[model samples]
Target chain A: MTRVVVDREVCMSAGVCEMEAPAVFELDADGVLQVGEPTDLAAVEGAVRACPTGALQLVD
Target chain B: MSTPTLDAIDLSERTFWGAPPEQRHAVFDLLRRESPFAFFAEPQVPYIPVGPGYHAVTRYADVEAISSQPALFASGSGAVSIADMPPDLNEFYGSLISMDDPRHGKIRRIVAKAFTPRVLENLVGNVQAVADDVVARARRTAEAGDGTIDVVADLAAPIPLRVICDMMGIPEADRAMVLQQSTVILSGGDPELVEDEEYMVTAFLKAGELLAGLMERLAAERLERPADDLTTALVTTEVDGERLSHQEIASFFILLLVAGNETTRNAISQGVLALSEHPAERDRWAADPGLTRTAVEEVVRWTSPITWMRRTATRDVELSGQHFPAGSKFLLFYAAANRDPAVFADPHRFDLSRDPNPHVGFGSRGPHFCLGAHLARREIGVAFRAFADHLPDLEVCGEPARLQSSFVNGLKRLPARLTGVR
Candidate 1:
């Protein structure tokens, strides 16, 4: 299983992560990055890479 | 195949600007219900013969599919509007949006270097300072004369325009001219900006030329005398040991000045309008400042600025039972998608706490997604915060004079009182 970590300080809520992996990551109502239990590593990596702010990270 | 509901939609040249959102939404709903993917022949103007129209992608899923699959549904042809841009205009005026894969990727990579995370972080304070200044200026205007602030010119418009100019290292003297030209470029046959349809294309072409020339001069200036600004950074910065040429820099500047400026301005102005309309949501947001982020997102969704972007089909494709040929155009209706009742509950209701809102307001589905999205969101949040804190009673003093352009869901003049009026 993989977990998504976000650098809250700089997360501009571009929503790229949510778009790339809507099932695994979301910019919540409070504008914080909320991670989902994503089984797909490809989708997770794509989200992390797509983030313009480089705020999203993947952890095992 | 013709459906009665599809026939009800009046998507003509006159339908975009000045036509209320209700009418637009009605058409969108009908399209989504009857023809989620259907042929759309734009209403013809006098001098302009109707081109082979487009496939209107109305549903959220179809829009996502089209936007995500840029290869199949390409952007380089007619990026912003319904009409196909001439090759010269596509190369020059289209800039980032006008190119397909190889070119789009190259330009995006180069431009992304200038708009780094550090640059975005720095924009926070700049946006805040500009927001505060704008609010103060609006307050004074309100106090000076019956407590009314035209939020578009006085509040929303100034911040984005000034910030974009500031970011690009444009002198204060030339910012006004840049704003004027970009306005004309996107005026969309509005009489206030141009005479009529006959001169619309000419007006767009001339505006693009003027901005390109101005930016060429600025790029030269930055090359000679480097400064701590985006323009200077773009002129000097390299990505993978590749630097942008003068033309690319100029075109990128045009995109920023035109699309970037208008998006934030409309989001903020319409945001104010949304709050005014939904007093309950407004009160909730004002009462609890923590929801500013949610409020900002709601505002963007409500406004849905930059309604649609055109994509040219590269090959024969099928979406939601509609077949599109290789050369056919597709107009992704983001405004309709944002308001898709299938995705959102009570889509029209302005709920500040609407969670899990994957709205395409800033268009995050593809490479052409707004590069300035984060900055725009922050500006909206910060501007709203300024009003909530500084003027707790702030509300719309009069109905906004909506801009007569379909491309941008905008307000030309938003009569607002920083202090809520009786």
Candidate 2:
């Protein structure tokens, strides 16, 4: 099973994760980044690389 | 028994718009023969009025002194030729190029960790491939019928534009518009392009908005699915327990897009011009392909696209032989300094083999010595080698058109004709 972690403190709500891998991450109503389910390891990995803040990591 | 009256050089009028090739070299020639270090009068901004006196430094030694000591001559003043800004744009100065220590240092560390030299070294083959492809296309276009190619459009434009896009993982479809927006945004001092203020303003805003949207989308995507791309690395890097904000990422993207494309493109276009003018030097490089690296450095000195950057003295300081009170303005001229006879032998000659060439084409030494220098050198050097090898008989078909911007002296259009089709 693939898992993901979004550092709440480091997440600047850049929304890049959501754009790159919507299934793995999304910004909350308050614009805070939140992790989602059905995480595709490759897609989530891509998002992890795309985040300018380095706030996301894949913990599979 | 008499002291020479110190006269400040008026590069403002000379370089107000882009200096023509002859005029550009003439100014540097004069600096080499006459005074290498002098003050430059403040360039007038047509509608905006703000007085900021600048002591221009032309000698390499003097420019080096100012650049190495950013504490003395800071880069936080927007790092532009014009000292004043329209209040609205003041708040948006967090980009790497415009920041001083601590903040600049912190941010640069994170970005550097992501785009390491090893990573850039890996991109060398890709850079060369892109240059080869672009040159091939230019040759094909020239052979098809027109028998003429605008070097800026055909040769100089694509290499950096595509390389940066690829590095950022930006889709190829978006490359052209991204390149166009970068050109529109950074052409700040060029009156010819900005003639229609309304058009320029609209384009600038639209470009910023487009970049912001791209950043947002990319940031969200990267957060979800980490990829092997610079944008992804930037969005994901952490420093001092603080993450970069969305605005920061957007600003970084915009800055890199403009800087990566503009500097490298100008280098390529200007490198071609340098080689064409110095046939012997060009022949030397062609004869021994190993000289590509040094040739790039020499071209950076020869072109030195960014002529001057303004700095303000925080505390009272003495530069060269003059003493200035606190808040004194200084303009460090990189182009003129590159030609100073003291630092470079046969400074006027564009020697491909010129070494120990500690040219400040990027910027003076210190905290802000061009974060993108490595990438630029790779792109420019590889591109020059490819052109020289493939288009062996390449020559400018007509008088190259100058980009009507003093800030970024590049060819707007370089009409060229090649002997044999690639």
Candidate 3:
């Protein structure tokens, strides 16, 4: 199983993560962070790296 | 164009145009601490009464929230400036940036189709070449003079102007005029740029006409002879089986030319000033080419180039604990939020290595986040890298001459030295 988490305190909500992996990350119209379970670990990691805030993390 | 001195003016005046740092930062700092959400009246315009006033959203979270909910805090009402723009100007000036979803989304997607990842990745080589040429010219001037150099003109301004021209396929003969008109438009009523206080309006109108005419010509040329450029891409790309008309292409050109040229140039000019003030960080960036990336990010954060944009409340909405009635105008102060202590540690310090740096210098999230961010970042990074490689020990030679507007946090002049290289 794979899980994702966000630290809202640091999240600027730039939404780069969403662009990298929209399936796993859902930033709202205003740019709130919403993480979903990902079937594709590669895409999830891409988002984790893309996040300027480092707000996204994946744990197995 | 006439700016009241900070000492002589009323502190409660609630104006940001050309105010000194002590006064300008005071309001932003106060708003971030006490009234993170508050209302202030727009400065009185010359001809007719414009905006009634606007609620400021200062906190980082509040900016994010407002940006996310564009539907609630709509952009169409007045996206260009806080002053209510006359309808004709609004339609002419407003492109994807000022529209709502469906339309905004569609236009952005069609535009995005032109800016493919490969095109951007390909631009890196071309961007670096431009950076090299820019620095070479600057070095020649520095070595010949008393090391006196106007970084804003000799160094910073050329990079973006060249890139935008290259990207848009603008004719070389017309590039000089486009730059001249844009400078006047974004100069923000500086007496040096505009004839008088009232001429600012006409200046912008004339500038708009100049750029629109240039774009329409380019659009027509690109259609006749499709080149490997954004103009050709804009004309050819179809959305839902519909292509962009000549007018839509011109609108995008106006948006891209102004936004692209001004933001990156200001960022570069301001970045030079910041680095000169913080030499240790400058040395750090110069020592390692890899550090240029982060340094560029820090500069963009430090100088929120686009300043603030206005959004109208579609319905009665509460933001940052303040109740805003429907039709209320909300100003998202990216310049303020970029420095909020809650988000950035030691918010005022110019730290190049600031991790988790999510400054909205490019404007925050939402469908309207800056489309040229990738290209802008590349421009800043490469330009700074070349500066470091050639003029590694540049120091401030004089005080910066700032632009006269609240909208673009621009540096009109920056005097610097090439140090030993001179």
lDDT (C-alpha, whole model) for all candidates: 0.76, 0.73, 0.77
Model 3, residue B407: what's the lDDT?
A: 77
Question: On residues B193-248, what C-alpha lDDT tens digit does candidate 2 reach at each position?
Answer: 56665465465667778877887888889889999888887788766887887667
lDDT of 2 at B97: 68
Docking class of 1: incorrect
The residue ranges of model 3 lying beyond 4 angstroms of the native Cα positions read A1-60, B1-15
Among the numbered candidates, top DockQ falls to: 3
Candidate 2 chain B: 10-residue stretch with minimal lDDT: B1-10
Please give the lDDT score at residue B228 for candidate 3.
Answer: 88
Q: What is the lDDT of residue B109 in candidate 2?
A: 58
Name the runs in model 2 displaced over 4 angstroms. A1-60, B1-9, B14-17, B29-37, B86-88, B91-94, B197-206
Q: What is the lDDT of residue B18 in candidate 1?
A: 84
Global Cα lDDT for candidate 2: 0.73
Look at candidate 3 and tell me the lDDT of residue B335: 89
* Candidate 2 docking class: incorrect
Question: lDDT by residue for model 1 over B1-422, one digit each (tens)?
Answer: 33236555656556455866777787788888777876767755444556887777789998888887778988887687677656766667678888876767655655654454344666888888988888887777887788777878888888888888888888888888888888887776677778777777778878888888888888888889898877786778664677876677777788888976888888888888888888888888888989986778888888998888888889998876767679888788889899888899998888888876778887746677777776787778888988887777677777777777877887888776655533
TM-score of 3: 0.87
Query: Judged by lDDT, which candidate is best?
Result: 3
TM-score of chain A considered alone, across all candidate predictions: 0.83, 0.84, 0.85
